[model samples]
Target: MVRAEILAVAVVAMFAGPGGAQSMDKATDCGYQAEVVAAVQQARKDRVGERQVQQHVAEKATWPENYNNAIPLIAGWLYGSDVSMRDIRNEDFAAAWKELCLQQ
Candidate 1:
């Protein structure tokens, strides 16, 4: 029940990014935003540890091969970071993931 609710919220976040981010070429340019949204919600799921969320994303996220590379970083950002999910505004996360790509 809870999982379903979170998944729904994740879907809303993906499409309803601030100021209609879906129109931008930079945001979700590679189509991994769905994966990111799902992973973010999964990372926050009740009683589901980060390890499980990481593993789930690693296996399930399908996009540029970088998904496996980015999932851990995404998981870390969503789970272990100081930025609360409530505080993270739309399309902000794409920049964070882009930073990881820049490092690699």
Candidate 2:
């Protein structure tokens, strides 16, 4: 799963055309948010994992600590809040990502 996610991100970065870091960040954040939301929706359907993401317009925020990629953010949220995906917010992503790291 991680490998696939990384590949997807890389492919997107490759064909996404050159842009300022801000544009790249916006794209990355959007992609990351989508993945996280999918996990939440999946968990809701599958009845597994925590659901802590709150559905809302997440205020722009930096990536979580000890991680520089979008994958970790989604992974962490899925692992931390199993069977309980809520609306995702940038503020809560770090804690979720931490859980994913520690648990895995």
Candidate 3:
């Protein structure tokens, strides 16, 4: 379970984009990478908006520290799927992204 969580976190972080250092503190505080990833997946499926994604991210605030390293992979997948930050905000993309990273 732990390993899977790490992988998920890695994958989500890969596509989460740059500028993650600023969020390290929050990621540590949240401490639940799986929850984050699940939220992102749900957000994408729900066709969420960017502002919502920002709000969701803000709610967790600390996801970057745990998943930032995987942003490239996550971004590639999201880009391939036409899931933009704007669209993701409306859903749980932020949480899902963290969950995905936990898998790695």
Candidate 4:
């Protein structure tokens, strides 16, 4: 019974109105955003650790290869749009920005 209730709650949370997280401005942009997020989320769920996620994000956002440096750019916009989008801090944002944008 407890497990069923938990499953129900998870379903409700998953299907909740789109008002909670920052909605992507453009629908087309959501595809890549979802892809990057899924990668990070999967890494976290696999217990690869936050450092692993950071490294993966870094490698994924490298220039002239994947998305031409769109991952962290999208992440920054998402961060600005929704404070609760992720637990990432300003320092993380800065590092990502520098690595993906400035150093690219």
Among all candidates shown, the one with the greatest lDDT: 1
- For 17-92, candidate 2 gives per-residue lDDT tens digits of 5442335454454444444445444444455433233322122223332122333444443545442334333234
What TM-score would candidate 3 get against the native?
A: 0.32
Candidate 3, residues 28-101, lDDT tens digits: the string is 42344444545445545566553455344445545444443333333335434455556545555546544444
Leading candidate by TM-score: 1
Candidate 4, superposed: residue stretches over 4 Å from native: 1-25, 57-104
Q: Rank order by lDDT, top first? A: 1, 3, 2, 4
Residue 22, model 2: lDDT of 34
How does candidate 2 score on lDDT? 0.39
Query: Per-residue lDDT for 10-89 in model 4, tens only?
Result: 32334234642235333323334345544444444455544345566656552223332334433333333343334443
Q: What are the runs in model 3 whose C-alpha is more than 4 Å off? A: 1-31, 50-52, 60-79, 82-104
Q: Which residue pairs clash in candidate 4?
A: none
- Worst lDDT run of 10 residues, candidate 3, spans 67-76
Worst 10 residues of 1 by lDDT: 1-10
Query: For all the candidates, what are their Cα RMSDs to the real structure?
Result: 12.2, 10.6, 8.5, 15.5
Cα miss at 75, model 2 (Å)? 14
Where does model 1 exceed 4 Å of error? 1-30, 85-104
As for candidate 1, its clashing pairs are none
Per-prediction TM-score to the true structure, in the order listed? 0.43, 0.27, 0.32, 0.33
**What is the number of residue pairs that collide in model 2?**
19
